[model samples]
Target: MGWLSDSPQLLILKDCLARRLLSCHVYPELRNLPESAQGEELELADFSAFLAQEVWPTLPPSFREASFETRSALPDDLDSVPLDSTPVSFVDTLVSYGITADAEGAQTLLRKVLAEYVSDACAAPPVWSSTRARECEICEREIPLTYHHLIPRATHAKALKKKWHPASMLNAVAWLCRPCHTVVHQIATNEELARSYHSVDLLLEREDIQRWGKYASKQRFGVRRG
Candidate 1:
């Protein structure tokens, strides 16, 4: 803990967890850093102050509070910190600090959260072809199809943190015609889309989307929905 205390690397880790940003394990720049550096920036002191003052303050009040609470929950006793002579692996050493059953519970929760974060960050983006689809997947109209992320990109960080969808489905998308695409967004909020209607099959299950798809399929390319 001494090596991490008041360090830029620790602050960055905390920031990632607080903001629900991709973890250092998956972030390319952080992962690429030399092991000796441990993801710390060159300007350690400046970076630490910046994170503590400028960056952390900009986060939501609730996030800041939560981060503070997690930090405060750690044991204050210097003797509780593991010794360098510990034979266990680094991670094992870190987790071994807690002597109580609650430590195991906390470890379980952390693993679940980290699993979701890493999976979402690792999911590949949809591979788009130079040639666009001739018809919308929804309405089957012969109009230019718009690429739509089933899980809205804007809500991705929050969605992953909320466990709305698994990492494998984060990059899922649908190609829809202009009208159908417009209606899809209009029909649900990003959270709702991530939680309930991410897949094309699920979108088709909605009466409004079904009705709109059928109506749009019959209309000519120039027709607009009122």
Candidate 2:
């Protein structure tokens, strides 16, 4: 386990495991490795075999047969090359095989993989302001300059809170203008706000106002209508 720490090789392996587990479409060779083999020691050949079987299958034929020697022949300092023409690193091939040292190293690889995933996922054109204005969902105000999830993400469990995952109940968010957002919080406690969030009608109906009014009158005025 200690050996895996800071090991880029191990990080790649963990990333491979994560992709496999998530069913992210891996090379057939990699998919063939036993589930238990994840996080376990592996010979380079065994790792290579897994990659060939799993990862290689999904890649283009040219990529599959690409010679690492030819790819890595560029000068050591890749920055010196033009943006459109940088040589690939042989180290990348080794990293992809998951022959790294340990779990910590695996984390590093996972971060890189996730970063790529984020980049790819965000490649779609950004939401145009004009288009957003036309389709904005929030009412009683212009759509918020920024969207905020109703359920504060800090309350969510660490594992399920991914940047790329679609927002949901466990991840409920709201889009509110700056003033409305502040007033919304100031008007109610977190628990009450969370409850009121069950429906837009409930929130807009000023049910929170009624609830708070009753509580305040009972405490200060001693004038309960009921």
Candidate 3:
């Protein structure tokens, strides 16, 4: 009779431990180990630098992955400000579940990232100006500007956010001059663009982008936005 009371409590504890183990960074390597592995032999291999970096992809999602899901929930359309936390959280989720850092995590993670990106398309909405009149969002150069679709149009179906505004309006676009646009496409995939570089500020923060901005805008003095 006493065992029954203990059973539920034991089950709860085991469930908690299982979730915690699933969240471990080393769990995957252990999971891949053979049943015949010896005690000390296996324990030594656990700390080996050889398999550590090589096996990172197979590791279970870390706490950071769980944290990401929380931050990416509220996009601009929800009357929520796009916090600096949004993109950071998104990548964390994507890396945890995305096979190659080229895809989003679960559908929810994908949706949030897409929503935030789509909202940023308007570039501080309620403040749309002439494309020619405004400076390039990336280089800040007042040059010939063009719109860059963050999700690469081809992925629009995968990126559509049913929770946000309409699909027609959810273009997830950004402004960039020719050189900046070229540099972005050169370095990022559609996933990277849609998940991270949806905003001018986000683009400006990258070291690679900084170098490109310097090189691209070398002779082109920026035109101040009207």
Q: Which segments of candidate 2 are over 4 A away from where they belong?
A: 1-139, 158-167, 207-226
Please give, for residues 137-219, the per-residue lDDT of candidate 3 as tens digits.
77677877788875567666655442122243236567788877888988888766655565567678899998888777666
User: TM-score of predicted model 3?
Assistant: 0.38
Q: Model 2: per-residue lDDT, tens digit, 162-216?
A: 3122223434445545544565668666545544443344455686544543443
lDDT of 3: 0.47
Which stretch of 10 consecutive residues in model 3 shows the poorest summed lDDT?
Answer: 59-68
- Candidate 3: the clashing residue pairs are 142-223
Off by over 4 Å in 3: 1-133, 161-169, 221-226
Name the top TM-score candidate.
Answer: 1
Q: Tell me, what's the RMSD of every candidate? A: 16.8, 16.1, 17.8
Best by lDDT: 1
> lDDT tens string, model 1, 190-214?
8788767778898999999889888
